[model samples]
Target chain A: MIRTLPCSAAYTNGFRLYMVLFYIFLIMPLVTICILAFNDSNYIALPWNGFSLDWFFANTNERLGLFKDEGLMLSVWTSLETGFFVALFSTIIGTIAALLFEEEQFRMKGFLYFLALAPLVIPGVVLGISILLSSTYAGTYLEENLGMSFEFLGPSFWLVVIGQFSFGATYVMLLVGARLKKFDRVLEEAALSLRATRLEVIWLITIPFLRPAIIGAFIVAFLISFSNFNTTIFLVGSDPTLPVDLYSRIKFSSTPVLNAVSFMIVVFISFAAMISYVINRKKT
Target chain B: MKKNKSSTFFLLMVPVLLWLVLLIVIPHLDMFFRSFRFENDEGLMVFSLNNYLSFFEDKIYWLTFVKTALYSIGVTILAFIVTFPVAFFLTKVVAKKYSSFMVLLLLIPIWIGELVTIYGWMILLSDNGVINNFLMQIGLIDSPIVMLYTNFSMTIGLLYMSMLFMIIPMMSALESLDDSLIEAASDLGASKWTIFRQIIIPYTTPGIASGGIIVFMLVIGDYVAPNILGGKSSLWFTEQIYNKFLATFNWNEGAAFGFLLLLLSSGIIWLALKLTGQKLEKVGS
Candidate 1:
């Protein structure tokens, strides 16, 4: 019956308590690991094992030098490279796909739209395995027909990038399509009436209008690609992505070093989120 | 009026058609064809239901399917329990200024990737981890409780990852409701609980349904959470499928497993749509 606070101060107190509890449950794990990154103990236990920066600087096998470890660093860099490439490929292709969807005359528009989103709906693990199989088969076919062996095409970096795109592009299309759904045709008409070319109008008007959504789609696709474990798992070659590395380590024997990496990720991602939020706030 | 516009439409439609053909439709056809084509002793060749037959005959395959389905439902319910109050408080109860902070706080969990969240939980649940030491300090127990790798740990990880997915849709739905209805109910001398049951709950029914469906679909399709948090002891279907295709060199059986997953995922999507959706009926004035 309460539209307002119901003049109940105790109710507000209880509500605040409940909200605090939810926040605690939601955030405690994240905060704890982050805090413990500075703990001096090799173990992940509590009771405060004396605070130090060694977790960040520790060069041991199982502690904080995960940041310094060459193999792990290479994997991190590989994932970053893959993420950038995937985001670049997917966002451009996907934005074009969104533009295409706005065209009214496509006979199979309904079916095509569903098909574009199918990758997203499929499990990442399934998509990964399927791409690997299909790509390997195609690679073999090409090798026989052309008399050229394409090692990279079979199961490699560019393949991982393209494999991720087989679906990652769909997400970009969906996000951009959402904003484009409310697109006013009148603006394009007005630009045309002003003697603006289609390209000019697109660059000046449509691009500006779609900027926020485009940025959002790009960032999301990047995050998803970088953090992706399922699809990347099958396509992973000698050089693994960060998630693949983390998954392998987690599978065999996890050390506190993985915790250090997670701690760094928390810091970096939160900083990025905060910056985006501020920029968005200022824009509005 | 739109005669020449068809040309514009054609020009625009080319890219999406090409994308669908090259990426999605072709691979799906490949998957279907590969399902029937069992890898023989002679190498990759023609078609049969031998792969599918093997899928049904194996107890391990069937058991994994059951476990995955059960985990999906469990995570959905747990997410529902965890997300409702936070969303409800944000939309209906909290002060306007403070609710923004609360919403932003929820973003912290989501902003960190699911892998990070799982690892974070792992540290806390480790034998010598946070909880164990805290318990020992409080004189609660002598031995550290080994909590990770259990089904309970896996469920917690899934719930954490999926809670935001549930919250966002539900909040959107709840925010769309007219506040005046609750006010009207209050004016009629209704209690807060009664008003909630009669008005707010019914109004947001679609929201809850859609939110639950969204969570259910995502949870079922997920293999990551279980893999990272489930430890080696648990045998999840996607893990098995991954091993078959990548590690074991059995592409045919893997395709069969993939097809089965595709079937189950699609069926869940259909059921969700059926339950939460209704075609708009022409209402009489």
Candidate 2:
């Protein structure tokens, strides 16, 4: 569909130039940070003093690398732990929601679907606050009324997972639901006609068909939880997630090592995204 | 058999519905009421509209609230303008094979995370940042200019941070458009500008509306870009809510502000949707 319109060559040239400049505008910052990660300078800023991996592996006073930094590493551990749990729970619950919507006779489907997506539009800060307040209120009520105490809701690790899952699940639902919409109903019916149980039909035919979307949803949920700061900051207990830790650290005492961490994360996520892209392309 | 099917359906829906009701809806309802309740000077709980009143009475709070709203709206429009052409070029101008790769370039920044992306912007726009340094090296300026911590920097950060949200929707909208319509218009001897305004713009209204909603909401809700990129001068509404909750420990006030922020963003989005004749259900999808 190349344009056969009476467009001038100058217009095409200008459009190409604009595209190149826009790409630079979009990418220059990340590229700069990546390049600066290896800078040998003590400052986080410029004057790139030759490429050095000191920021990543250096273990000494004033310049401990990301891996060696105890607090930072702990935050990284907590984030990974939270991300895993969040992804697992969100995928299971979200997949169920998608499947539920697939039923033609499902009651209140429209309203329930909207309710499912409510969290997606809510601000992360508000979501975090509401969840924290409600959980703490519930925790106190249990302690006073039921004479039992629960530590899980009071700025604990599980709170972070729950807070993240509240919204992350919506993402999973959308992804799986989108895939489910295009699925053929005949396969499920054919399997059922062959005396396959509902569970068996879903296990063999439906699950296999939805594998790519389910896996993709899991990865997306994991990444969202991993990088989420706006919501997670409030829900985080004494152990901050990687983004929270990086945020506070960047605010007070930023080092080149943070850039290194960013570089590594970018690489990891880019790899994940590329794999998903390939999978999706292959599916079609 | 019908009963069994309904039961299975119920079983499948119960967990997700319970999750949404217990975690999402109930908490929000609880917070909405909590916002109306304030603690008195005697340290006793009292229900009043004082928290919301205080938001209106305080000049800084109300002014900052308005400014944040304007900035968010401004960013949304700016982002739409900046990315519309790019999206059009990618979806319509570029060869189909190369467009996906072009879009992939946009995803890299997003994958890098907001904090890291803002950090990149900080390095690029700070006093001794790459931009200033480059300018100095070229003898364009005598010394570094303070680009960071300004409203300009904040807008740039917000625009860059949420560019993908705007781009993805617009690209999808534009891609779904029938190229034959454009060909027909051109063959009818209509100019490119006229075809774009009359044919293309009307078609992508829903996409534009959805993009505006996402970008405005995300920008207004964002704390990282404003805190880091806008620096000390930044008085983002989210930061105010944060301070009320964390620093002041005024949960009631924080809750009120939180709800206010939520309502303000949602109200604007609702109005925009109404004006554009788009539906909420369509916007979310």
Candidate 3:
């Protein structure tokens, strides 16, 4: 018989045990938060009271649940709105950029590509500050020189979208670009040779080829914009995204409702992830 | 036809080029200019190096900057050591079908909101937190150990935050290795350690480099874990930048510090690339 490998049965069993423990360490925190969310204890920690939904549904003078908390709900609404606008704008511009980069010959293409990728490498905090300062300066110039003012131009809802879209677009471009790399350009040329106009070829062949990537990029961008905190924190004006609101609430005065909100978000994201995993698993 | 194609390319490029210019390039340029100027007594903007000089003059600023860089580097190495085995185990030991499930399990924490993840850690590691309470109930100690607000807690949180970034790349790298190569080495009478060192480590260098770069950059630039878990003991560089901009309203100082951070991170990335001999394009993708 062939010699057994260096790792004995005991060694393999030990390694397997270690892997299980490591996975537990990776998952324990989120599991704890989920459990504590429904705990009847007013405090967020252990010593869980009887199972109750007060954190999710209760509204009283002392304890306000996630559903009844107006400020928290409003922030959630703002985050969804920001995610929508950022996702839409980033998807369009990023897809264009991806298609443009596929062209064989172009001037300054390398430099432009580098610039496009710069946002990915830069720290989000710095990106936020730079965007905020530049927009502030632009707003001042318009007010002083042109005798005009636009409320949307400042640090408001639109600015948050712009700030998030700055990097979100980069992500979309990368995703779409990866997809385009695998595309068969011969299909486009074949369509064009068949008396199909360029626009017709693109609409029929190219866009359909890119549909999966575009949809994937949109969802990815939306999730990123919704969860973004470092960049949006600086750019948010009167209204905060869910993350920023949760951050401030945690910093100052927090309740178990915060845990409830976290629980809801975790469940939603996990469900979305499971769906995407199923879809991708099916495709593969 | 060539001319038409070139013109069409230009038209397609314009929107994205404009977006990058108006938002990214121009804003960074604005920041660069802002970093170099200060308002005078006469309310006139004057170009000076004082903003940069202040960074040099203050011992705390530079010290904290160096400490943050070192701490992040330490975390990067620690994360690599911790995750490499997990990555290896997943790719080498587990069945193929279950590996994806394992990856998805690890990914849940990453895709969850960062703030919520941190809050989870806060509950676990705080003074009267889960671990402490459990330990006390077991008669390990009479009082809760000061787990939170220490450098230990900050590093733990940072490592947790960085787990997925480190693990994903390592898994991908290890997955690409040919199993037969290891089998061949084993058949040649090589010990497992020798095969791992001679073949696996050398082969996965690119993945290691990329993962290391991503993890180091993230840990260094992060403001959340350091602030929430680090408390007063951890003087993270991003916290300094935040204070300068938001607390002091000193945009000039903040801009200078921000550029410095950018420079430090980029410099380290360049060194990593050089040392690993991996192209930016290959590692980035």
Candidate 4:
């Protein structure tokens, strides 16, 4: 519709130029990193000295590929573990919250809805720090008064999971809630009238209808937890997630192995995103 | 039946209540209280305003706070300026079939996460990075320009990671706009600039406001870009909080700084909302 709007030739040409440059600005850095991942140079930067697969497959005293890097591999495993738990918990809880919000008879609906969405507005760093402080306080109090050590409350794997879940669930709620809004309630009523129990109605009918959103929300939650840095950095203890590990390594000294890590992440996430995109398109 | 309904409601409410109270509400409230107290020399915690007072007494803390707030606002505005046209082009100019593909391209970088993108920028902006190498090869400059670990690189990094947030919302808003309105305005003898300023701007205010709020919050709270891409001179407020927590091990001071940051960023966002006449709930959704 807007393509037909009458405009000067200069205006059209200028807009085209801007669009081209904007995309370049957006995509160039990513492409640069992906290209430099195979560079045979010792440094992570440019002036590439011929191409090699050293970053990915080679392992020696000087150049260690991603496959053989123990610390990097452990962090990757830790991230995957954290992402899985965070995604699972957030999807279940967020789906329930979505259902609750959809209930017309729910009390304090507006205020409760606001509270549910509050995590989205809060800054990640603030959330991370506040959780850290409160959990430390709680841990100290428990150990002092009750002689019980709550290791989960401190900076540990579970702490990272909880911290990420704090906001991860909000995302799932929003995603699932949007889908729930478009649902046909008449189908639920029909199943209920046909003598199906409420539990069975939800399980057999509603869950199937919401399957796409639930899957999408789970993936989104996993990605959120996997890539999280600000919040996870505070809550991560001895073992760090991939992002935290990458951050420390990059901050101290960056090798192309880091580029190898980024290359793998880009490939994995892009594949996941494409699969989800295809699923969504097919459903719609 | 009534009992079943209430029980189901109760069941659903339990997790939501636990999550909000245990994770969101209580932690923030605890941090709020912790911000007001300090540990004295006797190894005892006491109620005092020293935590808050120290922020005022220390020039670097407040200065960094101000700088972070200002830079975030600047970046937010820059994001809007840089992405608004792209959003407009995608929604209005591009063929419908290709627009989603373009959006997918945009989402790819964002999904790749900030750390990777920052690493990408580091590769592009470093002294011997791609940009410098190209410039030197082209004989544009005799020596490599120190783009990394500076304010320029930091802003570019911040803008790169966050511009998508601005674009996504604006695209949604622009997608809903009727092309007939613009056509009518143009037919009514309105100049291109006038139509854009009067018609298009007013129509997309909500998107602009929401995107601005998000971009501002993200840029201000960002620690990675500033710490890595920014030089020693470019000290962000989040870094101050991180230093208090990890470096000095002052949870009290860190808590105080954390609250101040929350208050400062939220206050700015609130003010921006009020000025733009956008409600928190409306923009948040």
Which regions of candidate 4 deviate over 4 angstroms?
A195-197, A277-284, B1-5
- In order, what DockQ does each candidate have? 0.45, 0.65, 0.53, 0.72
What tens-digit string does per-residue lDDT give for candidate 3 at A127-240? 989998899889989999998987666779999999999999988988998999999989999998899876677669987999999999999899889888888888888998
* Residue pairs whose backbone atoms clash in candidate 1: none
Q: Relative to the unseen true structure, what is the C-alpha lDDT of residue B34 in candidate 2, on a scale of 0 to 100?
A: 93
lDDT of 3: 0.86
Worst lDDT 10-window in candidate 1 chain B: B276-285
Please tell me which predicted candidate would have the highest DockQ against the true structure.
Answer: 4
lDDT of 4 by residue, A134-238 (tens): 998999999999999999989999999999999999999989988998999999899989998776777898889999899989989999998999999899999
Higher-lDDT candidate of 1 and 3? 3
**RMSD (Å) per prediction:** 3.5, 1.7, 2.1, 1.7
Model 1, retained fraction of real contacts?
Answer: 0.46
Instruction: For each of the candidates, give the backbone clash count.
Output: 0, 0, 0, 0
Q: Sort every candidate by lDDT, greatest first.
A: 4, 2, 3, 1
Candidate structures ordered by DockQ, highest first: 4, 2, 3, 1
Residues B58-129 of candidate 3 have per-residue lDDT tens digits of 999999999998999999999988888888888888778998888888878877867888889899987777
Error of 1 at A206 (Å): 1.3
Q: Residue-wise lDDT of candidate 1 within B98-148, one digit each (tens)?
A: 766667777777767777888888777777777787899899999987787
Instruction: Report, to 2 decimal places, the DockQ of model 4.
Output: 0.72
